[model samples]
Structures are given as C-alpha cells and as structure tokens.
Target: MQSYWNFPAAAGGTINSINNAGIETFKGNELDSLTREICQNSLDAIKDESKPVVVEFKSFKLQRNQFPQRAELLEAFNKCETTWKGKNPKSEQFIDQAKYILNEQEIPFLRISDFNTKGLEGAQTGELGSPWSSLVREAGSSNKGDSSGGSFGIGKSAPFANSKLRILFYSSQDLSDYQSHIGVANIMSFEKQPGQITLGTGYFTNNENSNAIPGLINLDPGFNREETGTDIFVSAFEPKDMNWVEAIRNSVIYNFFITIWQNKLVVKVDDEVISHENIGSFIAQLDDTNEDYRHVKNYFRLLTSEDSIQIPYPAKSYKKIGKFEEGEATLFIMKGEDLNRRVLMTRKAGMRLFEQNRISGSISFTGILIITGKHMNQVFKKMENPAHTLWEPSRFEEAPKEADTAFKDLRRFVRETVQQTFQAETTDTMDAFGLSDFLPDTTTVDGEGDDKKESLTLKIKSIAQKKKEKPKKKLKKKQRNEEFEDTLADAGIIPEGDQAGHSDEEREEGLGLGGGTGNTHGEQGPSDEGTGGAQEGKGEKEKNKPIDVEKRYVCLQKNEGLYRVNIKPEKKFEKGKLEFKVSGEQSDYILPILDVQSPDIQVISIDKNVVRFINLTGKKLKNIKVKVDYEQYCVMEVDLYEI
Candidate 1:
C-alpha cells in the first residue's frame, strides 16, 4: 500500500491551521518553546524512573528526495497556492515562498529523538485516547494522565511554530510492539478542486481515519532508535533563524536543570551533552550573568546542601484541597547573600513548572518546593496554566475559591518556613494614629516606657488654650488666632517670630513649626510653585536621562578601595559629573572619593560630592575606576548626572 496526502474535499469554510492560536503563541518564542515542550513530553512518558530519559536534537540538512512525502507534499503546496491565491493573500504569499524552499538543494531538518520513554501507545489499534492519535490526528485534545507536565495540548504546536513551511513528521516506537510514522501540515484554509475545499489541517496517511503509516523501513546512517521513544522531525528548518545549539543548552539548563541535576533527564544537541556530570560547569558560566537563571546557583544549594532542611508537615498547617493532604508536599530552603529570593516549584519528577518568586522578605535566599505524593501533584497540576509556566487559581475548575485559598496557604507555608528558618527580625515601629511619627518626642507622665508618653504639641496646645480662656480683649476671630500663636511663642512652644521653620517631627507629620524653641530643622527650600532664583539649578531635571543604579553599576574591590564603574551619560549633555552614595537601610549618604583614576578619563576638579569630568558630548559609555578611602566593608552606589 502506498502512502499519500489527502485533505478530503469540503463544501464550505475550512478550519485553517494558519490562524491557529495555539501555534501562533509559540512562533516568536520557538527556540525556548521547542526545548521545553519536547523535554516535558518525554519526561511525562518516562518508561523507567531508574534511568535518565535521553533526548537528542540532531540538526542536519537532508537530501531533498530523502524528505518524507516530498512529491505529495509539493502537490499539496500546489493546491494550497491555487485554493487561496486571490482569496487570502497570507496563504498565497506563504505558499509562494514555501515552493521555493521545497526545491532547494538540501532541506534542513531538526530530528528530536528521545530514549527510555513509553513512546506513543495504541498505534496498532488507532485508539482515540492513545498518545499516537492525540498527538498526530487531533488538535486541542490530550491523553496525558494525572500529574503530567501538559494536558492543554497546545505544547504539540511548538515544533510547527519553528517550521517556516508549517510542516512536521511524527515517528515513534512503543513498547506495545508497534512503530508508527506520518507527516502532518498546519496550513491556511485552501481548495482541493472546484467546489471542493479542505480544512487548514491535513495529515499524510493512507486511510480516512488518518492512521500513521506502519513505520520506518530502516534506520539511517548512525542515527538509530531501537529503544522505545518518539522522533519529531521539524522540516524546512532555518539555521540562520537561531543558534539551536545555544538555545537548546540554555533552555534545558534554565528550565529543567533540576530534572538533570536529579539524574532523571539527559539532553544532546548536535554533539554537545548536558547532564548532571557537567551541569555545574554550565551553571557556573551563567551565574550572575544571566537574569533568567539568576537564582539557579542558590536553588542548587538548597537541593544539594546538608543545611537545607525539609519542612515536616501539617508542621504548621494547610487546609487540604481534594485528595491533597497537608503533609504530602515537601519544601526545602537555604539562606545566603545575593539570592534572587525565589523558590522553584516542580513536580516530584523534577521538571520545573515555574517559580514561586518574591517569597523572600528581609532574608535573602533561594528555595525549592517539590509537590510530592500522587494526590498533591494532581491538585497543583490542575492549577497550572496552558503553558505550564504559572499556577493560576481560576484555571482550577475543581473549585475556584477553594483552589485559590489552598494555593495561598501553600505559598504562605513556604514563606513562613523561610522566615522562621533564617530568623530574620522585622522591627516593630510605634504607629500613632496610623502615623508612626505623629506623636513627638516626650517625657513619660509616670516616667514609664515608650507607649505611655504624651504628645508635646498637644500639651503645649492645651496650655495655650487655657491661657486664652482667661478674660481678655474681645477681638476678631482672626485676631484671636494670632494671639494664640503669640501665646504659644511666649510659652516656648515655638520660636519668637519664626513662622516658616518646620522641625523634623512637624515636617514629617505636617503639624507645626519651630519658633522661640531652640530646635532649627528647616531643610526644605522654597517650593517650585513660583519662578525665580529657586529654578536656576532645577534645570538638571530636564536632561534626557539620569544614570541610575540599574544602568550604572560599581564593582567594589575592598582591598584596594577601587570601584570599577561603567556608565553611559545622556547624549545631549556636553558636561557631566559622577557621584557616589553609600546606600543604607534607612537612607543614603554621600561617599567621598579620594581620587578618580582612569586612563581614558580627564577630570577637571572635584567638588564636595561631585567629580566633574571633561567634555563628553559625543561619547556613549566609558569604563572608569574610582578610588575611595580604604575601609574594610564600605561599598558605594555610583550615579551620574549632566552638569
């Protein structure tokens, strides 16, 4: 029996895969999505947990004739052109370019093969629920079991997203003694013949049921797959589109390092291998350099360090949701400096689903929470979004309200554990009338503690009121208020004639100002409400950009007090000054530099907190080193501004 393409005739509008939302979402992010989706599917089909699941990404340009269903596929492409040529410009344009690629000397193909997997079962019987049927024939249908990595079925579209021709071939061998292979295309809606059209989706198979061809007749060259697994051939691959080697390596290391670190997954891209043996080397190279894997090093510590303790459960409490009991989950955390303050959330199988981030409060650290036990995994698996990158309560159809609460409780348990483990203290401030500083400095009435003190402003106001109560001149309301101000001044509540100098406490709470009282705490200048001498230096705010901590950074070498700084000044500024500020918990203070040192820089002079440099009109960025007074642990945050 010969195998050929059949996009059966249709009467009316067809379901074009070109407009497929599932495939469209993965287009721009093909490299990352391809690695994630393929690895996830292989892990979900793990045939032996005792051994690592092996995946190989072989990128090669195969002979044009070696391309499966070449003639038949071109025939379909021909029909694709005629069917939608004038009606749909998108389809017409795509087919025009696709036909050019089909005739190329060598066709690019990325063959992804996985070993030690269950592969696609039910190929012999063509069962609808089989992995083979669900993957090859159906769209938006899944056969993944409980706690599987994916069930939304959109992940299958990731490979096609990388295909410019929008075509792929599926080949798999199951332990059930069946080998099945077929070609599938996701194209725009098109006509097959006059008064006949087909759906945007079509498969290269023999029968009407769209069963995959029996299998491959023989293995090619050195690539062989005797073990049970699947092979996804991405046809019409473009090497220039991306560096597949780096993409595959980084995606696995960033997203599934936990799986590899646990010795459960092994990946080979071209000839490079990434496994637990060399995983650290890969991570060390990316540490602090890659924002995507910013916390992976700390997360690795939590997994491998002896100090990392697993929280024993029902330990504090968690409200059970469905079959997930409070004790079924496990969380381990480690405290360290410079951690990204995130926790890796994953199934017991070790594939990282997503991160539960910003869990770190005063304490800096990284953590990992493994959703263990069958029942607990099921609950979280249901909560995962379509991409499996996040857990959303609304996605859990079991019970939205309860699921939301349970997820919160789960996060709280982890957060509380990290806090308790690190023992970081949060200072309790005296909040007076919702304003912590509303009540001023005071001597206790009974000479008691902080809580029993009376407000000094209120005490002075009471004394002034009592003096005003005595019979005096019958004055106007405005005069009466002026007399009160003078009375308070005489009583030493404020300065003699000072009406505009607000003390620190009064300024903070917006209460009153200092007068005859000895405290002079007027730091604020005239407001910007009017134009005059105040607006002279305020022109600095109009510059194109200000060099902040994010864009300009300093690498402090404590021994030498030399700070390596790199910054780009606003292009519009012809002159600029560099400044340094030592950041503290409460506020930042100026850090005086002893000298500015750099071969490429010429400094004019140094002001109190400013280092004025020579003309920088045309320069973009410069690497310069500055020296500060030698102090063991003093660090500075560098900033720049246009003079």
Candidate 2:
C-alpha cells in the first residue's frame, strides 16, 4: 500500500505550500459547485458519440483491515506527518486532519464514476499533453479543445477542495485497449521539511515499481471490464453541519440543468439516480424557477425550434461574423419578462456564455436579447478570459486583429439590435416610429442591407414620469429647410454655391467628428468615438464630393413625432460650443419611430420621406419639452450608416 502511494509534485513551491487561492476557486456552495465542476470534466471527456456518459456517486464505510498493506501505509503516514511538522511547526490544522485520516482504521470514502465515455486515457506520467497529465498530475494544465466546457483544468481541483481529508484516488480504464491505471493524490497547504519535502499530492497504484499507474485498483475488483470510463474516490468527505446529499443533488440539477436536458449525462447518488427522467422534479425544487434556468430553456427552444417569445414589432436583424464551418449567427430580440434581462450568447456546441446579473433594467425600461451564432467560436475565442466567466474584447488586447474585429462587430450588432427591439416593443403607435413611411423591406438601421459597417454610438434615456405632448403646429418645407441650413452653418458647412466660407485654418480645425482635426476613421484615436467627421480637402472638392453612402447616421424613434434626443459626442466640448460635424451632402437614412398610443396625448403630424443627416452637426441642440405633471422618457438609438 506504501508503494501504491505515488504522490505527484508541483513546481516553484511544493504541493504542501500550494496557494489557497487556487483551491479557493472550488470553494463556492460546496456540493453544488463540486457537482458542476466534476460533471463538466466528465462531459468534456466523452469519446464515443453512440454512448451517453454515465456518472455515479457512492459512499461507503470501510474497516482499517480492508487495506492491503495497512502496516506499511501507517508507517508512511507517520513519516509524512513528521516531515510536515518539520516544515511548518506553527500550523496544526492540516497535520491534524492528516493524522485523523491515516490513524483512524474505520474511515469513510465517497466514489464518483463515469462510464460509457473515453476514460482518462494517455501516458500515466512524465509526458505532457494528456488528459491524465492535465487532470491528475498538473495544475492549470488544460488540454481541452475550443469546444470543451472546462476552460482551465483547474476545475479538477474541485474534488480535493470538497474532501475533508483532501485525499483523492483515481482509477481509469482505457476504452481502446481495456487497460487499467490507478493513482492517489492529496491537496495540502505548503509546508517545508529538510530533505523530506512532501508535495501533499501523491499517486497510488498496485505496480511493483515506483511509477504510479492509473488502472489497478487496490480494493474494488469489478472495474476492470471492457467498458471504458474513470472513477474518483474521495476520502473523508463529511463536511460540518450540512446535509451533503441534498445539497449535492440540488446543485447537480441546477448547474447541469441544460446538460441534463440534452439527455447526454446521468448522475446517480447511492440508490437515487438523477437524470432526464427526473429533471423537472428537480427544477420544481427552486423557488423562483431561476432566471438562469429560464434563460437556458428559452435559448434551447430558439435553437431547436423556430418558436420564440414573440414581439409585436419588426425592427430586428440577422447578421454573421466570419465564414467558419459553425455557420452564421442569427439575432432575434423582443420585449421579454421585466426581470432577468440578458443576452443569451451561446456557441454551436451548446455552451452558453453565462454571466449572471449581466444586464440591468426595470418595467418599461427593461428588455431581453437572444444572440446565437453557430460559428460562435471565431468570436468567443477572443472574448473569453481564463476563467471563462465573462466575455469582452477589452479583456484581450493582445488578441489577433480578426478576433478583435469580431468582438467589436458582435458587440455593436447586439447593442443596436436590442435597443431597437426594446424601443420598438415599448412604443404604442407605429406612427411614433414612422414605420408607415418606410417600405417593409427598407433598412430600419444601418448594416440592415449591405456589408458596409459603421461604428455605432448608443444613448438611451428613460423618462420616469408619463409626460403628455401637446399637438404642435407642423413646420413648412421652407422653415424645415432653413432650420437644417442653420444647423450646418453652425458646424461651418459651406453650401455648395454659397460664396462666404471659413478660412482654411478653420476648415482644418473642423475636419473630424465633433469638429477636431485629423484622420479619424479606422485609426487609433485618443477616444472610443472613432472620428465621425468627414475629410478636409479643397473647398470645391469637399463640397462636390458624393455623400459617402457609408457615412449616414440613423436614429430610431418610437413614433414619427420627433421627441428631443440630445446625443453628445464624448470629445471636444468646450463651454457650450459643439464641435461634432456631419458632411453637408444628400444621403439616405430611415427614422423608424414607434409611439405607443396614449389617450392623454394628442396625435401629431409625421415625416414620410427618407431623412438625411448631412446637414446635422453637434452644434444643434434639441430642447425636450417637459410637463410639470409627469416624467417623460425618450429612448433613441444612433448608428453610423451608409446608404
């Protein structure tokens, strides 16, 4: 039995001196988290498509005499304690637990086994790049592919974190050759002893030599059959003052709810089996039906079936990034439940990028978004952190250029689509959104029609009180034209035939978005608002240049009636002077406004043609009318567009 105790060591510091932070990752809601972590590993290890993975949890009480080399093991345990004490004479917590597990003849253990999949197959030791090496021998050695759910192999440390004695045994059978392997390891605090350094992690096997093999079990005799899989035995797993069974079962059903729904994994605890057969019953155990659970279910429905939670409006778009084999991404959004609003981002492989409490809102201001791309790996690979808990491009500055683009494009698309969908659903009247003015096939926002992309800026304003707008007199064509001309003049836009013009120095100073001079588009800038300004050139050339079909800006209003939406560019604002500039050339744009019909507010006239922003600039500010009686809310979406 002493020969079976083949411990694996860590580098830089002994395993005894292992950092608690690494182990702390597995310390949340013990049983629930442990079940999720372990199940994820088993799922990732699946080798045969024809067979479903099977996991079993069993606990047993054994007598001291059950050990094959009890005396030799006791001697080794004594030596381990002596060495541990020499390293850390001050700390007794780890040593005390070790003494209990080794000195006690009647110790209990918990065993979890996975069947019908590739077991931990590969070299037992000395080489890298194997599941055995990553899972049992190395910390943070994750050889999992892109599709694998476990981001870092650190998840394997979960079992040790849950064990009272921090001791675990591994026994696996290679499915291909039906060969057996076994090993034992212990996770302990870092301690140093002269010439007696203990890594705390060790392997156990029946091999006559020192090398630890993965297959030979010291006690269980029935695991060597041809069927392949791995089994983990945990020693002294009784936690203080908690019902481990119930907690473990609930956590399994909660965290793996989606996996269980797919019918790929089954978990058993003693005589009680938890699988698809009882998934619903387990879900019933939750108090609020859990938003995360609902999110997963809704996503599955959208993924497998076309049926989705419907929205009354039609301001949504479907887009794709990269031409990966995983297929294009389709985006559909609508008004959803007031709470738990989220963007359900999922991979084709069915792993959702779950960031809890990600989106926040309330009542009329709240919205839900669902985003799915079959070839999501191309985008997500660049967005994930080592923990795989959050996804953001800013998280990866050193990533490849294409990956960064995918991240930016995907984020923009999701943001624009959700804002449009929310405002569309919330508005009561189609006239408010000017929906009747545009053809059904016309693009409601930029990027709806062509591949040309625009960097978009988002600003959402929610009014707390319901303000009534009195019907206003409609402006004549001449008055509207004058207002547009005045706005351009404020931004230093000279008319095509007008003689008066700003000096060349003034023109250069105003040749960018928000009126600052320089090349802005597609270049690194001092700010995030990529230059929305046009190029400065010869006066005649600048005036005669065709409207860059790609430079259009679009705003979506709930109703055709214009509500004051003030969009302030982040840069170059001095005093009250506005510097944002848009080219003064004719272009095409759509302003779809949805205004919910309210009996208290009178109806007003609406614009019925394409609106251009060539005359619009940051200098013009629209004042919002407020009623003393109610809080007025205005939500507007601004996107750079090319017509």
Candidate 3:
C-alpha cells in the first residue's frame, strides 16, 4: 500500500491542525454565518404566507474529527487549490466583482444613493450571482452593492475575528428556478501563518430536483422526497468574550428575517427555523405595543460605491393600542463596519451611530434602539463622546429652513406628549403611584369625642391579661389529680351503732350524780335528784351556751327602755359617771326608759335561758333622755318609696 505518511505535506498538516482544534474552533465563523443564514432563511420562508410562524431551537452537539490524514488530506487540498487558482482572482478583487454584480442587479430598488459620484437616483443593479460569499470574495469584490446588511463586503470577515476553524451549511430555494438546494462552506486559519485562511464549498444530492434547483444539492440526504429548506453547522471556532446569544438576539431586531434570506431562502441554526413572522412577533413583544409601527414608517437606506442607485423607499407601519402602562417604545438599529459596530442605542434617533472614526450616523426615531452585528463600526465612529453632535452625520450637514421648522414642531410635540404621559416634572414616586391626593391634609384631631381618638392602652391591657390567664386552669386541673384526691373523700362523718349498747349503764357509773343504779325512786335518790340535778342541770345548761364567762351583765332601766352593761367596779370611770357610746360618734350618751313600770330591754345571766327586766325610778334630769342615734348604725339601706 502507498504510505499515507508520504502524502502532500501542506494538505495533511492543515487538515490535522483543524482536526486537533476540535469543535470550538470549527464553530468559529461558521456559527455567526449560520445565525445570519438562518435569519435570512426565516424571511424567505414567510414571503408567501400570512400566518404567524413559530421558529424553534432544536438540538445541537459537536461531532468528533473524522477526516483522513496524509494522502486523503492532500487530495482534498489539491482539489480546492486547483479550483481557487482557476478563478485567477485576488481576495479583494473578488469582493469588488461581487459588489459590482449586486449594484447592477435590478431585482429590488435601492433606497439611498449617496455613494454615487453625482448622487444620482433610480439606477438599476444586476442580480447577485449567489446570496452568500466567502471572505476572499467579500474582500476582493470591487462593486459594493446592497443585497444584505453588509456594504463594503466586509460582513463576511466577522467570523474570523476570534475563530481558528469554522464550518457553515445552508439550504435555500430558488423561486425563479422552482427548486431547492443545500450548500456548505468551511474555513480554517493556518497555525504556521495565522493570517492565512482557507475555505471550501460543496453541494448535497437528491434523486428529484422538483423541490430544489436543477443542479442544487439536497439538504437531507436520507430523505427520499425533496423539501424546501436549509440547515447550517459551524464548529471548532471560538466566539468573542462578549455574550454571543445576546448579540444574536439584538441582530434579529434590525435585520428582519426576510432580507437576510435573499428572498429565496429558508435557514435553521442547529435546527431553529428563522422566519419573518417569528421576527415580527419578537419585535412586537419587544416594543410591547403597536407604536413601533409609527417608527417603522422610516426606511433604512444603505448606500455603497460611487455608482450606487437610490430609489423611492416605501414605508410600512404596524400599530398596537393599549393603556399607557406599557413600557416605553424601543427601536434597534445595526450599523457600522466589521469588528467595530455599535449594538445598543437608547436615543430614538441616534441608536446606530458608530464610534470608531470609520462610519457616522444617527439611527434615531421615537423609540429605544439596539444596534449590532458587523455594521456597528461603520455607523458610530467614537466611543469617547457618542452623542448626536459627535456621531450623527446629519449634525454636520445643513438643513433646509422648512425642514428645520418641521423638526422643531416635532420636538415640541414629543416633549409635550412625554410630559403628559410620564409627568416628568413631578417626583417619580408621586407620579408613578398617583399619591398626590393620598396624604392627610392635617395631623391634628378636630373633635373631643371623635371615635378615632379612642386610646389603645385599655385594649392592649385586656389582651395581655387574657394571655397570662389561659395557662392557669390547665395547671390547677393537673395538680388536683396528683395530690388532693384523699382529703376530699373523707371530710364529713359521725360514729354510732355499737357504742349505744355499752354506754347506758357504764356511762351512768362515770357520771358524778349521787343517784343509784337503775329504775327505783328513793329518798336518797330524790334528795340527790333535787340538789345534784339542779346543780348538774345548771352546769349542763352553762355548757350548752358559750363558755369563758368573764363578766355578769345587768339591765338598767331608762325613760324609754332598758340597756345592758358589763363593767368592773375597780375599773375607774374617766368622767366620774357611767357613759355609753356607739361606734360612729364621739359624744357619750345615756338612754332612759319612758315608762319605768315596764322596761322594753331584757338581760340574762351567763348560763340562764330566761331573761328578766328591772323597774326604774323616775329621776328628773336635764339630759335624761339621751338620744341614741340610729343613723350611726346604718349598714345597708334599700329605698322603698316607690312601692
């Protein structure tokens, strides 16, 4: 066998380097191109339909290297080199030629022609041979014409900015030819000479060409039937440190799905279908209203080359109406040259102004702006001061008197409208929440008994008490069960029965009475009964009443009744006379019975059950009738006057 190691050195080494770099390197420029191609494809897909299209991002995974080494790599390289040499064109020369073709084509009208030497209008451009171009052709083509977003054909150079290896695959329909075709392009940067680059192209095959261009390749080789669509793959390349997904999302705004597709395209990245309807929906959601339709009335005119043409640009508007609660309107503009494009612009009229000194303009209107992709560098030229005065080309040009007056009127209208809607002069909190009328006019209370003036102290106190008392009942019940059961059960009983039989005769033997034994009546018993019974009965009667007899009481007769007294003779009277007083008053007073013959008061001895009254001697005295006031003894009284 021929030694595979002896194969062409240049080709094998190049292929090997690319294989080693892996998917990220291959993904490089190819990913960007794929994004652009898919966006373009979506636009083409929606050209003939009015229904909203749904584009989905499907699966994407990197595959390993599989290309052969040495001889096989040499053969592939030779084939590409031979084909490229056959064209006999430099890279810049090819770009110029492509531009010339686009400018000469008459398929669509060019909106602005400032690049033309005489600033002429309404010139025809020829048809662009292929909608897509490699970096070599883009750099070499002399004629800069409008077919897509790129002007100097530099848009194709964007993929090489941060990538080492790249691959791109796309499928499109040729409406004129009534067929579909699949195309693939791949590129790689050489390790030996980092500046050197290589590219390749090929097509797929299918039995039926009805759904594709006659000589075009079929995108899905396994599918027997032909379908009109495209797919792209970009691998092994590294993207810039910036967020690529956000960059792509922003690009979708300015370059609508239709224009990117070249009017006969349908593309997918990994597998996301890119369509105008889907892009429009995205823009609609972004603006949050139909107000964007008003801004869209203006046209984006891209002019290239000295002989470029300008045509009357028609404007289309779409509107959405709702309350003012929706967010402010935003407009996105993509402008500038490759590698230096500005991607975001907040001003309505100056969004896409570039800052790199290469391009200048304003993308201003009445909305928010996001400018991105390869064109940012050509639009805004300086980042130091990127305002309207610095970046907008219009600022440097003279304006007609009428135009100036019209612009002034428009500015006034915008200012007034913004004021009415946003109330910009007022504080943000006050305007946003409409709280101007909510503040209290006065802090002081107006009335003495206003309900709102009730104190919260009492309510708080009651709530605190209830919280403290709730746990006590549970504790008491638990203690009763554990410690107090027996005391409660035996509290109230009397003993009797067997004690009565033994007590009669034996109880008499212990008695101190002089009576003998049982039932017979005798003189000794009678004498004993009379004396002992009397003394015993007296003692028993004394025992029946309260004991600790400390005094003997006597009833003294007075004019109206009799009063009882307990006094010791030896206890000296403070005033040399007897005095009686009640609890409430300070004066001492004595009461006299009115009829001495029958006293109303009664007195009894310590153990006597009977009482006796004494007759009083009438004596004339100045204060004999002592007033015993009952007022001092009043405890509780009830009013019975109504009855």
Q: Order candidates by TM-score, high to low.
A: 1, 2, 3
Q: What is the lDDT of residue 70 in candidate 3?
A: 21
How displaced is residue 315 in candidate 1, in Å?
A: 7.7
State which candidate, 1 or 3, has the greater lDDT. 1
Per-model C-alpha lDDT, please? 0.68, 0.48, 0.26
Query: For each candidate, how many residue pairs have backbone atoms clashing (under 3 Å)?
Result: 5, 49, 92
Candidate 2 error regions (>4 Å): 7-15, 18-21, 67-77, 83-91, 123-127, 187-196, 206-210, 214-226, 289-306, 309-339, 348-353, 356-375, 378-383, 392-405, 418-643
- Best-matching candidate per lDDT: 1
Candidate 1, clashing residue pairs? Answer: 494-515, 494-516, 495-515, 495-516, 496-516
**Candidate 3: regions farther than 4 A off:** 1-46, 52-73, 76-152, 156-170, 180-229, 233-421, 424-643
Best by TM-score: 1
Against the hidden reference, what TM-scores do the models get? Answer: 0.66, 0.58, 0.29
Question: Candidate 1 — what's its lDDT?
Answer: 0.68
lDDT of 3 at 242: 45
TM-score of 1: 0.66
